[model samples]
Structures are given as structure tokens and as C-alpha cells.
Target chain A: MRSILNITDLSLEELDQLIATAEDMIADPKKYSEVCRGKKLATLFFEPSTRTRLSFEAAMLELGGSVLGFSEASSSSAAKGESVADTTRVVGCYADIIAMRHPKEGAPVVAARKAGVPVINAGDGGHNHPTQTLADLLTIWRNRHTFEGLTIGMCGDLKFGRTVHSLVGAMARYAGVKFVFISPEELKIPQYVITDELEPRNIPYKEVTTMEEVMPELDVLYMTRVQGERFFNEADYIRLRDTYILTPEKLTTAKEDLIIMHPLPRVNEISVKVDDDPRACYFQQVLNGKFMRAALIMKLLEVNV
Target chain B: MIIGQIKDGIVLDHITAGRGMDIYKILELDKLDCTVALIERAVSPKMGRKDIIKIDQAMDIDFDVLGYIDPGITVNTIRDGEVVERRQMALPERVVGVLKCKNPRCITSVEQELTQEFKLTDRKNQVYRCIYCDHKASK
Candidate 1:
């Protein structure tokens, strides 16, 4: 009935229900395809994100529902001088459920307020991206069977990584989960994340400049690329270009069972040689994303689990 | 050692020395055409060393921006050689218009028509973040 503004909006009880429902969908896919046969999903992506937009579409299609809307703002009326409220008011007429992605931080919050139906935040500007965090949780649960008692090494650009921030916030809610942040000083995790979430929760963590030192101890290695265009000086980007590269040589020291995940469209951060290895679960993570979305769509649409 | 008697004006004391230019830029003091006395290196017990700006005819001063930039400032509202309202600088709740967000792709910055709004979160450190963009305030 309300908007999916942030991951915190979903209570722990609801999270459990979603997890159970997703697990049910995973076990039996065909049993609930026609559950929401006539509903509609409208994806309003103001930015370019082929993977997430595709996953949302696939999720809707798998439920025997339909998908409508634009992957970019140019194709939509937003290229005009229309406000977010006006756009959502228009989109609300056609959509049964709205999933919006915007470059502005609170654009979805504004959209959700105007939307006639449920609004899911696909991504927001350097802010919370709840659904991706959902997929991440689902992926972790599916593989490891639990969220706690693990050291997750989030390497690369932690300062600008929205997914990493959301994941850190979500994991702090669990028990016995420690974090090993591997990033150069220029791209270290923001101070607010440590002060507001990790330290306050009494969650133990270590900040390291290199990945190789902590690679063996990590249960999961979540990689995100350093955004070069954000740097005011090109030299700063050059200085920390290869602070973390998931090459096979580095993995020789890592545990055989250590799972690797990336919010994809990866650059040279992940070497191609690691793709052939079974532990490289980024593509599998993508598949898992679709399943997670399918399960999410069904539950959100009031389809039977 | 500079001295001026205030008949009807506000004397903003305890500002950071050499930060008067930034404050002037932020408030657009010259455009407003108010009589001002810009003082630097004023000595006070609280600030040991400070600066002050006296606006002769400014009806409304944004104490919020003053506090946000530097909490050490003291504001004195005077009328007829009598101090009307005087207090230390306090954090502003809602800053109506301020600097643009650091994010170039942000809706506020790109949209052009929308005025930027920022909430003052950290008062002591003067951390102001845009409400819509979540971009850090750029000095």
C-alpha cells in the first residue's frame, strides 16, 4: 500500500515473509505464473541501467503481467520541463505498480507520494537503492543460507557506491556479521556510514587499503568500480586505478568457497579469467536477481506464494 | 581599534577573520545596498580572536547561514543606541536558497528552475546536505 522508499521501510517481519515467498517461488516457478494475469508494471528509469530495467521487465513478464515505460528519461515526458509529481500523476493512470529510477535522491519519494499504486525505488542518486539490496540479500541467503556470521569484503569505490552503502546498512541489522572495507583512501566509505550505521550498531569492521591482505578471510567479495568521472582531477583516478582487481592470481590465496558478487557492467576490476571459475557468481547473481524480482513482483501484486 | 556608534543597525560579531568575503558573497550584501561596517581581527573572551560585520539598514539577516558557516559569530540588533536583539549564532532549520549541489547531474542543478534546499544536519561542523540530491554542501 505504501512506497518502497528505503530498505528500512520493510520491517523485519515483512522481510521474513518476502524471503519465504521468494523461496517458494524459487522452488515452484510455474505454479504461480498466472497469479496476476491482468496487472501492469510501469518502469520509469530516468537513467540508463539495462540490467535492472531488464530484470524488472522480466519479473513482470514471468508473472504473466505486462511491462510498460521507458528506460531513459528522453523517451518519456521528463525531457520536457515537467516536474516529478506531474510525471508520476500521469504514470499513475496507466500503471498498477510503478518502479522508478531517478538521478535525484528523493525523486522516487516524490513519485511515490503522487503514485496511485505502489512505488518501488529502482535506484536513486547516491542514495538508497532498496531492490538491489533485496536481490543481494536473496542471493546471499540462497547461497550461504543466512545473513550473519560472515566477513564480507566490499572492495572498490565505497565512497560513491550506493549499493555498498545500502548493503552495509542492511547487514548491520543482522547478528555476527563483520565487514572488511577494502578501498583506497580517496574512495573510502563515507564517514556517515561508519558513524551512523556500523559503529553505533557495535558491528566490528576493518578498513584496509588493499584486497589481497583480506581476500582469504572474506566469505563474500562484493566489487564495485571507482567512478572516474566523479574525480575533479584525472590524476587522482590514475593514482588508485588498480587498487583492487579480482584476478585469478589473487584468488589463489582466497578460499575455494568464497563467493564473488558484483553489481555488474564491470570494468577491468574483474579479470575475464575468473569468469570460468565456479566461485565467480556474478552472472549467477544476475539470474538470481531475475528470480528474486519475480518473487518480489508476485508478492507485491498480491499473487499467491 | 575601529569604533562606530550604532543608532539603528545590527552588529554581527565573532565571525571567522578573512571569512567576511565568503559571507558577503553568500548574503549578497552589496546588491542589497545596506550600510555595513566590515571588521576583522576583533578580540573577545569567547573567540580570543574574531571578526564582525555591522549592517546599518538590513531588516532581515539570515542568522541560519551565519551559524552554519561559523557558530562563533555574535549577532547584535541595535536601535537608537540601545541593543534590541543580541545572541550568539544558532543553526538554521531551513535554508531557502544557497549554493548549488555538487552533483552536476542532479535534478536541482540540471533543472535550473528549481531552487536548492538544504537541511543543516551537523551544526557544530556545519554539514549541510541538499534535501533532494543528498550532495554535500560545497564551500
Candidate 2:
């Protein structure tokens, strides 16, 4: 059974295939609508994530598949202190596939091992969120037409942003892609990502503090929220939250075709004024998220149009 | 340092000095009923000084633990007071339940029944990342 626990789990070929499938779904939604007819999807969200849960549910619904399962741990068997593995095994019998979101990192990994059916990791704490990266990739593909040679600038909380890490790792596989990490010193990209992902692969990248310094050079400016939940200290979160707010003024130096992306439910990082900017694609990223998820669901389910 | 020879047991030789205690503690050899010897800072011509652990009874040894704690330690199987077989330790590709992931958000932290597993990602640096959260195992 195929399970997507991390973005790295999908090879470049598989990623391309999923992207192609998403594009096809976009081209003719009615053709692929009932491909998963009579199938069931169990959404075992051990935490509260309305957007992700809705995205998964909508994807299944669009695929003509029925959706089952809980939204939070309090509603699920997890509240009774049942293990993820146990719940997954039980749910596998009821649903053809599972999309799980948990507050604890690698909780879906446990579920995947026990699940007889394919398990999709929606989000796992501040860890791998492969589908978000899928959405980001689709957005990039739609905007830039290729992953090669794009100077991508990632700003805000690079350290704790799993989407940034996953996206960086995914994009590193493509040829000639450059990364510009723009974040405060405290929220700088993790060292392991530099040493392990970028350095080893000879992917050229630079770390900078100011967004304006690298604004004009980027083909993609990936903005991320400084998540308050990720920070242990509320004061630290408060101090760093407003570090890199992307305003329309900031994008004056940016490329006219520059794609502004964010794994959504964003708070104030990208100003409301920037939403009117033709370059802003964060909302488009949300719609792309649904399509990519539908593609991912079909792939993991081994369904055909 | 005079230590009694084992009749039928396993001998761990050439452990990097100062890590014998770590090996002992991690292996939980102190709980063993049989005679277990941990010789520290013993003179070695090749290594300047080394640690050796000798177990007086044949038991299932975790070679992965031995390899991870200190690689290149020689394992000698003593049968009737004679070394019957000798094996050399090397870095294991994967280790389970040997190291605990320190990442608080990791699934292993909340799920006590789950095995703590790590895979060797960088061989030259000897870096093992948690299989669950990809957190680097603390040395």
C-alpha cells in the first residue's frame, strides 16, 4: 500500500505524475469525478484543523467517494487514550483509505504501519505536511511552468515552518533552483536543512534578514506565518510575529510575475492589501490544494479515470 | 587490572576508552545475574588505551548497540575458555530502541509503546535521525 507520510516519500517521477494528474483533474473535472465512486475515506484528525479536514473531505466528495471519521481527538477514540495504531487499524476496516492529522509529529507514521489501507498524512505537528508541499508544487508549476532555475525566496518562520522545509526539500530535486531564506535570526532555517538538503545537493542558497534586499531577485516569494503555537515563549512569538509582513509596497521591487505562496490560514504576514496584487497566489494555492489532494487521493487509492 | 576469564561467554574488546560505562549502562549489563566485567582504560598498543567488557554467560547481545556506542570493538565468543569466533563491529544502518528521540513533539514521546528507532543518515558524521520525527539523536 502507498502512504504519503512525508514529501520525500514521493519520488520526482511520482511527484510529476501527481502533478500531471492534478492538471488533468483541473482540465476535465467531470471525467475524473466518479473514479473513486463507492470508495470511502476516513479522516482521522486527532487535532482541530478545519481547513485541512475540509480540503480532504472536499477532495473525496469531488472524487465521488464518501468521507467518514472525526474532526478532533475529543470526538474520536483517541480521547479515550486509544493508540493511533489501534484507531488506524479499526478505521482501516471501515474506510478504503485514511487521511490523518495529529498534533504529535510522526503520529501518522504509527497509523500508516498499522493501516491496511493507504494512509495520507495531512499534517503532523510542525513536521512533514506532504500535501501542502504538493499544493505548493502545483502552484509553482502552474505559475512558473518549471521547477528549474527559479530563485525562490522563503520568508517568515523558516525554522518551525514544516511547509518551508518540505517545499525546499522537494524543489531541491529540480535542476538549478536557488533558495533565498529571509527570516529573523531566531527563525532562520534549520541547520540540518542547509547541511543535509541544500549543501549536499550543491543547491545554492543564501540566508538574509531583510525581505526587500532579495525581493527583486525572486521568481517565487513563499511567505509563512510565525506560528504562535510553535514557539514555547509567547513573548518570543509576539516579538517575531511581525518580523516580515509582505505589503504591496514590498512587492514594488518584485517581478511582475512573481508568485506569492503560503500554506494558508495565514495571519497578517501578507498584508490584506497585497491580496489585490495580481502576484498574490495564496488563495489560488488553497484551490490548488484541493486539486492536488484529489490527485493524491486517486494516486494512493490506485484509481483510474 | 586482573580480571577472571570467562568459560562460555562473549568478550567485547577494543571499546574506545571512556565509553565502556555508556555501553554497560545502555546494555543494562548490571542487571545480569552472571559475572560481567568492565575493564576501563586498559593499555592497548594500537589505541593507546581501550575498554573491554566480558560477560561470563552466553546471552543475546545487541550488536547494533555495540556498533552504535563504539564501533570497531572486537566481539570474541568464548566457548570452553577458548575464543571460537571473532566478529568486528561496524556502524549499523538502523538501530531500534537504542536511543531516545529528544524532540518533545515526536510521536515516540507521547506513545510510550512505540519503539524508538533511528536510521543512520550521515555515515561520516555518524548521524542517526529518529525515524518518526527526523530529530537528530543526541550524542
Candidate 3:
């Protein structure tokens, strides 16, 4: 009867339950693999996202459930003028659970209103991507083995990065979490997020132009890429872009136990040279995403597989 | 300028003055064959200048249509030339079909037959965005 529209929709209790389930799945994958054997997950991605789409499909498939629905918007009935409400209603008939990723802000809200089954917002523009937040939560929990009293540095493209927003919202719920926002002036984290989520909650945070200054003090370094097209001033973009590139030299400044994560499809943001570090957890984050998603699919559908 | 009122009909008041014409055209008050009188720039302290729409027939207006008319207007029901029920009709929490989404690339904006829906996110900002395209319809 409920939908995963935003991170706030999941209460602290529900989030704890989801995180616990994800940890259980991660601990023993085979034991939970067949919990959704008879079910189906309909992924209606209005915006084409190969990684997120594949993650949802992989989660469902590994759970022994089948995947259906369109990866691209044009491939679906949405191309021929079908509203999200109508599409969800129609797709809900064929699938047990629905996951939608739209370029629009509230497309999933429309889907949730009319969907006969549970709806999950895979990603909806720069507005929200709650499931990714779930993955990040599980990853941070598993890597650090705790959620509190960490200097979390969110570096690069914080302005329009929905992942950063979701993460900030999620982490703000935890105790003694300080945030260091590292980004170029133009790509500084949106004020709405800072004022609305951080300042009001009295979560201590500071803005920094360089990662090295805060990198040494950080326990978690979450990196994001700066797409060339996102910036109107090409010169500023080029200048600051190189500064955020994580090389092996950067790790010398970071704590040995520091966990680095990127919501992948990264382009030169974190050099491949840094991937060898034991603290690099982006790949592990990907696997954790699958486990978290599998946990979500099973829980939402009330299936064991 | 004495403009008459309608009995047992809806009177939309405090319309930020000149927007009454836009609402007349948007609601297509002419086609309804309802006796409609539009007054612009009538002085008032609340709206400074106000526009009032007196509809002869009692018909439930789409809240989206009401908001599209003017973000500031309050829809009031009239009976026997007296105010019976008056409430500011909000651009509902969720809008089905009223205004065209401005984004050319959005699926809803491109589809000619689609019923455009916009979930009003920033109520205080008076921001009503397209659910299909994330486009804001600004006046």
C-alpha cells in the first residue's frame, strides 16, 4: 500500500529494517536468492540508466524473479502519449512490483498514485533517488561498521547531484555526523539542501574548495564527477575539474581506514590508479546496491526469493 | 461602472486585477453561454486593483483551471446575489489537465493526447511544475 517515493517516506524504523535486511542479504546471498521466484519486477525507466536498470534487473534475477518493462522511454507506450499514471496502472497488471526512473521530478508520484502494486523511484531527475541512498547507507554501514561521528566529505558536483542530496538527507538522521562539502564555486551544494536539511537540523558542515585540506580528516570521501556540459563557464570547469581527480598521492592525506565511494559511471573523477587501494569501496558499493535492491524487491513483494 | 452580479453562481474575486481576461479566455467562459461580466482595475486595498468574474451558471471549476487563471484568485460561491461559500481554490496537490507543460523534450509535452499532470511542490513559492517535464508554467 506504500511507495518508496523519497528517503523521508521510509521512517527511521523502516530504514533500520531495510538496512538490517540488506546486511543479512550481504552476509548470506545464496540463502536469500530464491525469495522472489514466482514474482516479477517491472522496471519502467523513462530515462535510460544502464547501471541502475541493470542493478534492479540483477537484483530481481538473482532473487529468481523475472524482469519486464522498458529500459528506454521511447521503447515504452510512453512514446505514444501514455501518461505515467496510465502506464503504471497498465504495467502493474503484468508485474507484481514496479520501479520507475523518469527525467521529470514527480513522475513517480504520479505512478505511485495509480499503480496497483508497490512503486519504487529508481531515479527522478535531480529531485530524488531514494534507493541509491539506501545502497549508500548499506555500503557505509558495512564499510565503516558504524554510521556516526564521521567527517563525511562530499566532493564535486553537489549542486545538481541528486545522490548527494539523498545522502545528506539520510546521513543527517544519524548522530554526530559532520559534512565537508568539497566542490567548485559554481557547483557548490544547493542552498535549499544546506538551509533546509543541514542548518535546521544543526548538522555541523563547512564548504571547502580543495579536497586535500579536509581529505586527511575525513572518514568517508564520496566522490562525484563534474560533467563538462553542466558548466557554462568552460575555463572554470577545466580549472576545478583537475583539482578533484583522486590519485594515489591523495590517499597519503586520507586516513588508512577512510572509505572512498563514487556512484559510478565516473569519468576520470577517481583515477583508476586509486582503485587498487583497499579503502576504495565504489565497486563494493555496486554490489551492495544489488544486495540492497534485492532486499527491497523481496520485502516490497513479500517474497522470500 | 456598474457591472451586475450573478445569482446562484460562482464569483472569483481578488484576481490581481487584469488577469480576469486571461481566466475568461482560459476557462472559455464565452462558450459556456453563461452570463459573464469581467471588471478590471476596480480599486481595493487587498488587491490594489481587482478583477471579478460573475458566472451565470453554477459549475464546479477545475482547481487547476482556477489556479491557472491567477495564482492569487479566491473562488467564491454565490447564492441569491450573496456569498454562500468562499475559499481559496488551491492549484490542488496534484493537477491532472489544465496547462501545457513547457518542456519540449518532456514526454507529456510532446504527446498531443496526454493529460498533463503537475504535482505542486513549493506551495509558498507558488511554483506549479509539470509532472512530465518539470517545466514551470509562469505568468
lDDT of 3 by residue, A87-108 (tens): 9999989999999999876678
Looking at candidate 2, what TM-score does chain B attain?
A: 0.92
Given the true complex, what DockQ would model 2 score?
0.84
Poorly placed runs, candidate 2 (over 4 Å):
B1-7, B33-35
| Residue-level lDDT tens digits of model 1 in A37-96 | 899999999888899999999888877899899989899898886888789889999988
Tell me how far the alpha carbon of residue A201 in candidate 1 is from the true structure, in angstroms, after superposition.
Answer: 5.2
Supply candidate 1's per-residue lDDT for B6. Answer: 70
DockQ, all candidates in order: 0.28, 0.84, 0.20
| lDDT by residue (tens digit), candidate 1, B94-132 | 676766777775666655656677887666566777766
Q: Candidate 2 residues B20-138, lDDT tens each? A: 99989988899999999999999999999999999999988899988987887999999999999999999999999878999999999989989999999988888899999999998
Q: Which ten residues in a row have the lowest lDDT in candidate 1 chain B?
A: B105-114
Q: For model 3, report the TM-score of its A chain.
A: 0.94
CA displacement after TM-score superposition, residue A135 of candidate 2 (Å): 0.6
Task: Report the Cα RMSD per candidate.
Answer: 4.4, 1.6, 4.3
Residue pairs clashing in model 2 are none
Q: Give per-model TM-scores.
A: 0.78, 0.96, 0.78
Computed on alpha carbons, the lDDT of every model, listed in order, comes to: 0.81, 0.93, 0.82
